[model samples]
Target: MAVSLFYRTGSNAKEWSGTFEELERKQAKLRRASQRILERHQTQDGLSEDDVQHDLKQQQKLDKSAEKITEYLATHQEKTGIKGKPVKSNITDPDSAKMITSKGTVQGYNGIAINDDKHQIILQAQTWGSVGEQQTLVPVITQLKQQLDKLTKQKQPNEHTIKFTADSGFNSEANLEFMAQSGFDSYIDDNQFRKRNPLFKESETYETEQEKRRLKRSKGRPRLFTSDDFHYDEATQTCRCPAGNQMWRSGVNVNSYSQKYTRFCGYLKDCKVCPLQHQFMRKPSIKTGRQVQFKNDESRQKLSYGDKMKVKIDSPIGRRQYGKRLGAIEPVFGNITVNKGINKFTLRGQEKVNTQWKMYCLVHNIEKLRNSLH
Candidate 1:
């Protein structure tokens, strides 16, 4: 058996009822109520000192309400802190995160699923509050491994080679390295995988959208000189800026993620004299010259899992195998989100939300089994 495993993000964008959203709604209501309460106590004529004191007490009440809301935001959900420093907790679903969907910002858990290519049966389903999908791959695979082990114990051969297919969201250098170490044959699309194929380049749609996105990000400002604008000399181990000024290798360093890069900087004399100084450098005001970083060959090899996947996925065999992924996974999401009307999760905590998701996946598998038998 080919034993294809397809993984995908679930479709339902959970309706955000987080503490932040709830707080805004509650604050608006409280403001209106407080205003009415203050108006009732206000004197019709010019206010006396007693009237002023009463108004101050009413204002104090409003301040106390706001203070209480702020305290709740600060103190609530201490155990499961929000990612990238705690800002505000979701009052309704503290475990869920505010994710930016195509529609807009949504407070919800990201639902993940793994499916069998044979019958489109869901092998695993999980819910995560993290907006990033990079961290979820290992967990999903671990769960699937356990399930497969159980099946092997039931007399099925465990020697079959398993191949995984997923979209660009699950792609990462770390994940790719993990797959190689674990002996998994996975075809995970990188963000730029499509650009490698001649067909995609021939098509104007990708190019057009890319230009639009680039223009949107640039916001009418002239595009600054990127690293691509510099020419490298492999023999000399030097770089030349777009203005033809030679740059010396400043230093070699590795980032927090262990990615290595070499920095190049032009002489202050050269950069200061260059006409393209403003076009190339972001900091011409400073006395320093222009700087650029180039990824070394070792670094490229270490982090080019996406690039490797591009070569694999561009092949006819690769395309045929990956073609099965969408069909295997998307139908289940459609069934759960669209057909079953599970547009939003009603559950609260992560455990409960996960259980609820599995229940729906179970329903989907049962339906698939029923249909196959018919």
Candidate 2:
């Protein structure tokens, strides 16, 4: 229960990592091989209609994926572009997303829940096919309203004053806009919430190997400079160090996931005896100064909703309500994932897994009711 467990009977990481071309080749090969088997069975008049139907259903899924990829290629010719990645299809479970959990990469659905503050009772629980929890907020809230209506045998009041607090995963401009109009007291934290809070200023993060070694060398000195400390000029193709010194282009086309960055390093002449060498701290043996990478700038759009929500969540009351989020919502998942031992779902696809998650939530609420009665 401490680690994520993946059921490898249907698919694994390797099976879901193929590119579009590889998927087509493998899919064709499977079809040909299956066709031969079916033909052989039909020759003996022993082929089952049920088996044929299942084969056709799987073929239809493969066909649909091919069409989707073809349409993507029509608009976007490049395979490795940022807007879209090479299609990753799980033949076993096409609806599942490639999720990066606390353990590692998992080919499964993301589960979500809405819990009441008082009783920690789940108002709604569902599973999404996508890895991003940001997209799940609106759908869950909309579904919760319907559930409440059915439970009460009437529509809930427009101004129910229900308090809603969610972690940063559910924070977005659109979601914040929805929360603003939902007639509920809501607090949703941004990803930088902890860092922005003054209380966490002393917290240390060893994000790089150099940082870890530097921390040991400095023995609890303030954190060293990072990529954010430097600046890159796209128009001039230049980089500036933290000390406002010019740095040379040490490397180009440094790949990080789908994005490319240009690396710049401080000159040895300027850095060896520089007073702020710790700013670009590197190995003691290396002659080069600190290094950094940056990509081309993308235009920023005005997010009125985000700004409004930020102010709302940064208020004194916002801190207290959002603080309650962990105590109210997290324990329900912990009880199911750890105590009930449903950390890794046994089922595949969104619908079945969603049903399974709701059942577990139901069991959790039943436990709460039983404990209250006792």
Candidate 3:
């Protein structure tokens, strides 16, 4: 499956950005305003005064309920957790999600398209409002299966013939296990896949000229120690800072982008008096000490579905099959987005936006047909 994000017509500036504290304050202010209106009417003496008093009492009761909600919100602080961010819903299109594209973060939808490798024709396409693609594999593949059955006029479509290959974005343990159990040939790359490739072996060395100029610019400056400077022993499961002080293991396994890493932290006491602390630490008055993370290497004997897929994708045959993906789907998207100029959706709401994306895919297929007749 080939997926991409397209920015729509909304901006973060248009979004009502605030923390839980701010929201609590706003709710409290609203509750106070309601109370004032109720109190102002309570003093009035006229016909239906009983009804007015009853209505005012009900309003006050509603305000008290709102106050309870605000109180809960006020006490709990909003935090940006690891691999988390402030979720903003746009006033214009509430269904659109906040996406980080190559250009930058923008309000958009993730449009996914599965293409026929032979002709690079879109087999199935859909748009989702979620930022992550990991959860989309099953639904998209199920749709593709239905489409394949319809087009091929086969009751039982040869699932073996049609292999599903996707990028790392769709790769999850569940997804890999699904593909494996369903007996579908697949290839999905891992984060460290490129490290195995010889093409990037001299990648750092190729930028030697740039590095020399950078070093020359900061000739007298001492190079600050980074996470790489920290020594970690896998056998002992121990970490030591650059100053030769043993650090405490803060977290056993921290997950990021489907990869696990062990987190280590230095004690403030140890970091405070270290002679090389200034060289490694960000600041002298820092609350905490240096932190380092080392990638976890799970045992091959106990390989998970994701780990097995990683090994498969790094294979020569897997690389060859996966290599066809860019040509199969990318140019089709590039021609539609760049050549045909159908980049962003001009509609609002999920149904409308999804319809527009499918229409674009249909247009691309039509163009392909037109070229084929010649």
Candidate number achieving the greatest TM-score relative to the actual structure:
1
Cα TM-score of candidate 1 = 0.57
After superposition, which runs of candidate 2 have C-alpha atoms over 4 Å from their true positions? 1-14, 17-22, 25-87, 158-160, 202-303
Identify the superior model by TM-score, candidate 1 or candidate 3.
1
Scored against the true structure, residue 335 in model 2 reaches a CA lDDT of 84
- Model 1 poorest ten-residue lDDT run: 1-10
Q: Which sequence of candidate numbers ranks them by lDDT, best first?
A: 3, 1, 2
Report the C-alpha lDDT of model 1 over 1-374, residue by residue, as the tens digit.
11222222333334323446567676677677777757866645567779778877877888677666666667765423424543435545566666777657766678888887778888878888776777888888877777777988855432224657888788777886555444345667767666654367564533577755875887733346667555555556776654445577888774525667788988887787655565677667367788888776643423244544554565445566677777767777778778987666776678988898888889888988999998
Which ten residues in a row are the worst by lDDT in model 3? 9-18
Per-candidate TM-score against the hidden true structure: 0.57, 0.56, 0.56
Which sections of candidate 1 miss by over 4 Å? 1-88, 154-160, 203-303
Report every candidate's CA lDDT: 0.65, 0.63, 0.67
Q: Relative to the unseen true structure, what is the C-alpha lDDT of residue 23 in candidate 1, on a scale of 0 to 100? A: 74
Candidates ranked by TM-score: 1, 3, 2
* lDDT (Cα, 0-100) at 18 in candidate 3: 41
What TM-score should be assigned to candidate 3?
0.56
**Which prediction has more favorable lDDT, 2 or 3?**
3
